[model samples]
Target: MEAKKDNSGRITDWRSYERVLLPSIKDLHRLDVYEENGGYQALRKVLVSDDWTPAKVTDEVKASGLRGRGGAGFPTGLKWSFMPPVDPEVPRFICCNGDESEPGTFKDRQLLEYNPHSLFEGILLACYAISAGTAFLYIRGEFADWITHIEVELAKLYEKGYAGKNIMGSDFSVEIVIHKGAGAYICGEESSLMNSLEGERAYPRVKPPFPAQKGVWGYPTTINNVETLAAIPTILNKGGDWFASVGAERHPGPVLYGVSGHVNRPGVYEYPTGILITDLIYKVAGGIRNGKKLKAIVPGGSSTPILRADMIEGVRMDAESLKEAGSMMGTAGMLVMDEDTDIVGFLRRITHFYHHESCGQCTPCREGTGWLEDIVSRLERGEGHYRDLDLLTDLCTQMEGRTVCALADAAAWPVRYTVERFRDEFEARCRPSLVPAGISI
Candidate 1:
């Protein structure tokens, strides 16, 4: 595939990247060819080379300006550096978050499905950089097919001496274990994920003595998104500066954007940051599936605020800038809605997800999510009154800042933003009328 942007707006690069990333993603099913295509070269180099130190790896990553691709876009190297100084007495580990459950975001699954060794190598290198002896890949339980993909690929990697004890015949070691989560959206959050991994119902925990200070059985454990770890090999192998150039200056690298809904070719595309949202939906996805008109979009995942068609101009695919646009670049889940889409019905469906997924550990999120969904359901069915909108706003405000974690805030952001931007449509349907007493609302 050519690396240049085409007239169609779809990225014409990954077909060629497949050649370069062969065995990694290029020749995935063929294990021997994977090795022949330079699969474990990066890990071998890092493990055997005396010139590079853990500090050097961390410093280079910091210089690269690579942020977490999961959503928040926190600097990856900075987060890894938060690991407390290696304590021989205390157990230290790194946990790779492969639980990709965000709505409209399935890009991470492709990375894990088609080319899992990239993630494996990345995880091993992360442990090596942080001096972690034991690392775990926390994969979501729903990925039944990819579980076999990962299991097979991992066994091949282990046979190649890329994993298990004493890798590359060196003194350093990182024993990787694959643990699965029992389908929970909250498990995508790091703390809640840790909880689920520990054989309990996934729920948020208090912070301040954050996960870095104590985690995973009360040891210093590092949790990073699967996509975050997948970027490590390329960054270390090609130099951080090169990796930084792949995307926009703020959040650089080839972001795997999952563009779905009302698009012709709705799938994941690897592209540089700052690509116009219009180009992505229209050009890349073949212009909204058919002759339909574009309406609004969720630039990030569902947690982000909505952006009307006019608002997508010059929107860089970065973190801070997306926040400036009254949305977040969350999990790179780009959902495009068509003009004929029912805005009320949409919110009803999304609100249902927030309510069902709420852990109920906290009062505001547990109660508030249910309230938001009830209001949305009523409004969708044309059974709501005008005062209900005010009630919705007030309830969302109450839940926004009072939860144990950001799940409550996540539920409220879209509810508040959808009404704020599209009140006319909602009010048109939801406003109560004392018409005929015989007629149903």
Candidate 2:
């Protein structure tokens, strides 16, 4: 099949000949428009037909090999299977983590706004699979527009018997409640989100009893990202093999990449995984803005390590490939930088964000993030010392494994990567000629 580029000149048909998860549907946010485009067909197929049992629904997802879109890339089916056997006496819950707080990550917000029914359908299927009676979607408070979009569709569902009790005239009933977060970055974490939803401070809880074991309100629960669940209805409508046939072999599925920074066209593009970084930047995102040479690219979200332009060569945008490149496929937020970008100054801004967002629950994250911020701020202002580089590296090493969560590690990666890859720039700033007099050698 020939590849077709959309009106915006993006290749609609990428590695996969089809668009499964994110199809080009007009007026998709509305319930009527969604139904016209085969929106709730999957839900009806599973709910009305006796053939699709809850176990079958999970097995199909397992076969499809869908991974979590929220950074970790954990298999979605495997996560659902982790829940303990459902007890009729005790209710299970599903929490949709719609808080897209990661820097440069906004794909979830699109799903929430443009294709909300897909999320609702996916939630219904998940509720059935896990025997969950109650489902809560925790949207970030800042997404006022997205909140309005989803709430409008949700009201339609309740009116049409697609949500609320006795869904689609079946004995299975699921209740979905929308909860807005208090705009805390830490609340993006699943455990912390649960804490926030329950009216507690947004600090991550100890995880010996993982969410599947004990979650919101201290009950059996499962949490999935908006993008992760959004893929479910597609998997159900099409067989699992069809879903797995596209994208990278190991992590086969359509993936959404949010391109920002110095890209010519900064928008969310959905393509099968395993697409080369260079291709996405050049072909998809229209290369470096203003035809400038590429300096670096954050292959995933800000949490992942940065990749020098040279390192990005021949690198496929998938979980394992990005990991092999000493980074991660975090939220797939591909942030590109051009020749004029200042590595030290750029990373200092990132350091400030993490330092400010650290929940202060763990000593290492609480203190280490502040130290990173101070050091990077100094480096950006040309007040850095030669010895400060080593101190910063040591500080990052101390923060990585010692924090209660990955917050400290996220704060450390850009600092470490920018210093390592673009050391000449940082070193130049710390030179005796550049350092101010009386600043101490």
| Candidate whose TM-score is highest | 2
CA-lDDT, candidates in order: 0.81, 0.87
For model 2, residues 1-441, the per-residue Cα lDDT tens digits are 555544644333475346555677887889999999988899889888999999999999999999999988999999999999878888899999998899989899877767888899999999999889999999999998788778888999999999988988999899999998868999889999999999999999988799999899999999999999999999888778867866677887888889999989999888888788999999988888788999888877888888888898888998888889888899999899999998888888999999899999999999999999998889889988888888889999989878667788888888887788788888888845466778885
Candidate 1: segments with Cα more than 4 A from true spot? 1-25, 433-441
| Quality of model 1 by C-alpha lDDT | 0.81
Backbone clash pairs for candidate 2 read none
> What digit string (tens of lDDT, one per residue) describes model 1 on residues 1-441?
345544544333333332222233456645575556566678888778897888888887888788888777889899989999988898888998888888988988988866677788889888888888888898889997887788887887688777887888998778888887778889888888778777877887788678888888778888988878887877787788867655466777777888988888998887766667777887777888678888999987898999887787877667766777778899888999999989999999999999999999999999999999999999988889888888899998899889878999999999999998889889988755556878785
Total colliding residue pairs, candidate 1: 5
For every model shown, what is its TM-score relative to the native structure? 0.93, 0.95
**How much is 334 displaced in model 1, in angstroms?**
0.7
The reply for model 2, stretches above 4 Å from the true place, is 1-16, 432-441
- Choose the strongest candidate by lDDT: 2
Give per-residue lDDT, candidate 1, residue 331: 87
